[model samples]
Target: MANDFDTIKKNANSFIIEIHKFIRENFQVSIGDQKKYLDSVTKDSVKTGQAKLGSFIISVSDVLLDSMIIIVYTFLFLIYKEHFKLFLAKLIKKENHPALMDILSQIKVSINNYIVSLIIEMIVVAVLTSLGLWIIGIKYFILLGLITGILNLIPYIGITIAGIITVLASLTGSGEISVILGILIVNIIVQFIDNNLLVPLIINSKVEINAFVSIMGIIVGGAAAGISGMFLAIPLLAILKIIFDRIESLEPWGYLMGNHVPRKFAWRVRRTKTQE
Candidate 1:
């Protein structure tokens, strides 16, 4: 019995030592391989980051160059505004000069009003969105609201993007589902007010564009030039509408783009003898 006990003790000790040896050997090998992998990853990441930064710099430079060119062109146009007006007048007969002048004046007024109204709309949206987000306990509510207001200028797509950003920003805070829901509700309410009240009174009244045409224009513009195209679509359409309405030959096309409902489809209450 004593011999058996001694043999069992020796076997147990050997097993423990073997395990310790195995762990020591494999641990060193694992650490070496891991270090190599980390080094490789670091080198690759640096190269990738450099490439990304280079691309970003090129894109920014191009944008800046284009913006500068536009500013220069605008300055030149302002300096020689009367010359351009005379140039346009020269294109038509002297008899049509007054009409052309009238058209140009209308265009100027429409464009100016549209721009002013747009700024007002942006301010209203930003304030309302910020207030709602703040009330809901969202962090960075002001920044998010400002972003939303700017993006809202893009028509249907802008508000959707703003909502997505607001929700994501909310996630960084409480990350609660209720908070997400609150964000959605706020966006919906704001959009409702903007579309129904603000747009009708401020923008649509000045532009006089129908919803169908506006939506189609936005879609086509987005497809052609992405976000910039979408942003310019409405104003361009409005301008086209103005031109079309002024020209006798293009009146029908202008009517097609306008929000005027035909008399046949108009709702009216017939007068009854008692009511009369």
Candidate 2:
């Protein structure tokens, strides 16, 4: 853990150094003879360089604080969990208690299934990606694959970012354009398999929402709260869908949000003569 932290810290500092150098190197040639503009950009660049160490310190502090808060909250939630269920039950009338229980149960099962599927999918993707890249002779394949797999959790956007990064890594490692193209092709194939086979079998089975709606939710979440929001949008939508489906007036909303398809229509399954 300590070694990993040191590696990350070294990489972070190197990244900042490279950014500063790039800015300093390019600003003179890229811009015209606008003295005021150049001066402002230079000042900002200097400020950024100066703040690099401070920013790293702040990030570490934030991680520690967040971990501490999560530990405290987890302990509290575990201790008072029954109380929470009681509080939820009391929110509705006694006559509606059973329906409320069913709704909450649905939410619990769906979310738990979704979370488990995600962890499993991420592990598979990471392992496969790393092994594939290694076989293809890419440097630092393990690190790249791990990054790609984690990013892949963010849905559509993650794969795009991973593709770009993989291509860049390939180009840098091999200095051959062929390597870049190979990486892109490999990534595309992997993603196709993930989308059609793994994801449908795992995640989509649990949280069946409309693709267009899911994309829009991710966009809205990204706009509202950045990466974390985008990462959480689908699962949150699934939970909301369960609640919406249970409430009489909100059933229409849930229906609109879902895939509205039968499970037999799975991509991998062929239409038999009887079905046809």
Lowest summed lDDT window (length 10), candidate 2: 28-37
The whole-model C-alpha lDDT of candidate 1 against the native structure comes to 0.78
Off by over 4 Å in 1: 1-80, 164-173, 264-276
lDDT of 2 by residue, 1-276 (tens): 233455444554555455455566787433234445668888879878779968867755654454455457658977997898899888879999898889878878887888898998898888878888887888779998998888787656567778767765654444444465567777877788787777767776678877678778889977775555666677889989999999999999999898876567854355564477
Worst 10 residues of 1 by lDDT: 265-274
Task: Give per-model TM-scores.
Answer: 0.64, 0.61
lDDT of 1 by residue, 61-175 (tens): 6544544554576589789989989899888999998888888888788878888989999999999999999999987899999999987876665687688777656655554
